[model samples]
Target: MNPLNLPFDSDAMLEGLRPWIECESPTWDAGAVSRMMALAARDLADAGAEVETIPGTGGFGDSLRASFPHPDRGRPGILVSGHMDTVHPVGTLEKLPFRVEDRLAYGPGIMDMKGGNYVMLEAMRQILRAGLQTPLPVTFLFTPDEEVGTPATRGLIEDAARGQRAVLVPEPASADGGAVIGRYAIARFELLTEGRPSHAGWALKDGRSAIAAMARKILEIEAMTTEDCTFSVGVIHAGQWVNCVSSECRAEVLSMAKTQADLDRGVAAMEALQGEADGVAFTVTRGVTRPVWEPGPGTMQLYDLAKGLAADIGFQLGCGSAGGGSDGNFTGAMGVPTLDSIGVRGKGLHTLTEHIEIDSLAERARLAAGLLMNIR
Candidate 1:
């Protein structure tokens, strides 16, 4: 039975989300992100939650954990997880702007997660208002650095998952309103090439072009993409002068693995490519790593439960896979049951066109509230 039938206010949810979206909490801007977290913490507190603040990597903003105790003491419950950071920069709002048109709320971070966060907050409020008795305690973990792979809050998430029944990640749902089941294991890499520099016009033969070597390595790494693994050279930096032979070059490569074993094998292959370029020494430095959330029994169980809840709430639920990673990857990798993309219905994540279906705010809140009160 849907406890929150006609109880959620979609207009109120969007109004509440306005200040948060206007806050502009880019991951790199620590102070800005922290401010955003504070606002959310206050809202959670007002909604009968006790918010705990954990200082994050000094300048990259802090994390928040909000717990609703109520009467469920011995029973374990859900860890509602998400990130406050958006890929958009501080001034992005001036261009993209926040507005409602044709039932879509357009803005930076609106689709990627701000709308989802609002849905979560509203759901909890509805659950409390409905006086629903849940056998489990609901815990909310908001990280400031998930856009960068949760480097600052990975341990925090895993620790919060301890003895919990499940982790619910409210990343934006598919534009078609599908829930996320499995995600590609993700890794970041910085590949650097070192070579001797010489004047391009005078002694081209004497110089070993680091830029050329980096280009070749980028191709080799990009060629590794297949049915199970994806490699992308997202960024490359080399050379200052057009005349001088570039001596130092760097490339930022992102790898997505369909399986953990595939991730390992891909890394080994990339490592082997080091020093393969003539006269260029290669160095590979790994950044953040998130394991694949393979669909296990627990995952499918959660999916089925969600589908049942959706039907009960007067809607049907669909499940899908994601190429990106989030805190869901952390808990899913830890073998704890995790489900994601269970947020506002939206599309164009991390882009200027990012927006969410305004109507889904109420629907998502009802669905999430139902899951919270029912899922074991």
Candidate 2:
């Protein structure tokens, strides 16, 4: 029952990768993402899989959920996960078309994940062709907007994963080329302040400056962070000019908490800023983009299963955790055993230098197929 018997065309996989890279499908650009999903869905459905396009939360690309029943497997399933949205913004394609030189292919989202999506697609195709009976069923979720925050699609991912045996995320390979097993929780906050404006020279003493108050709050927020619980004042917008005391100022914070207690403490510190300034009004919006994922009961078992499967296929596997976040964090947080960075090994991700290892495609595809074969 070698899963490598599954039908796979390296040429087809390469074909899929080219268009994905040539198109600039950023998280917010729903149109391009939709087209990509449709193509993937059409191909997947033709291969005896049920497919559904989950509409996004009023954005450019929604999510695509597809399931392939094993020849004789029953209920419990394994989900292969990835995101469609990339960090590339609009017009990036023209700036950086897909290029190949010296065994490297560079483009917008190739390694970050487009190539991983291809790996999944080709692996599934090969499995179906082989007519193998897997021990468990397989589900694939391609979410949009993962590059940004997965605010619009978190619930969908959780719902698909409920009662599943485990979930696998194909984020890019680690810098050390090892697979990732854990990730940090992400919290983003917006700080807005409002104050009455007055002439800088004539009535400066009477008006409270929103920008000054905002600056002080930013400093306090920074001081609240630690080595494990990190924080950054990411974006700030405020004030008009020097002629008048500014009436409004806004700042955004991106915080990463290492543990549940750290998250609670960070949130409390963020909320505490609301009443710090007397005359200036303040508001805060908080979002936990992804939850922290560490080795636990469900996850450790899942890792052992995946590692065992990889060993059977002759691929030595290693695992590590990361400070960044992903949808894997969401399911892993919900108590599902989760493993990430199962995609093709690659060097650069989310940059113009992004590329997937051409040689790893076949091996990783076989690895994915084998993992799916042992899902239950």
Kindly list the per-residue Cα lDDT of model 2 for residues 305-356, writing each as its tens digit. 7677677766777787788888888888888888888887888676667777
Native-to-model Cα distance after best TM-score fit, residue 138 in candidate 1, in Å: 1.0
Q: Count the backbone clashes (under 3 Å) in each candidate.
A: 0, 4
Instruction: Give model 2's clash tally.
Output: 4
lDDT of 1 by residue, 1-376 (tens): 3565837878888999999999999999999999999999999999889999988784679899898866775367788888999999999999999999999989999988988888888888877766766668888989998888787778888998877788888988865688988888999999999998999999999999999988888888999899888999988999999999999998898899888789999899888887645788999999889888876788789889888888887788899778888788888878888889989988888889988888899888988887787777
TM-score of 2: 0.87
- Local distance difference test scores for all models: 0.86, 0.79
Task: Give candidate 1 regions above 4 Å deviation.
Answer: 73-75, 200-205, 241-243
The model with the greatest lDDT is 1
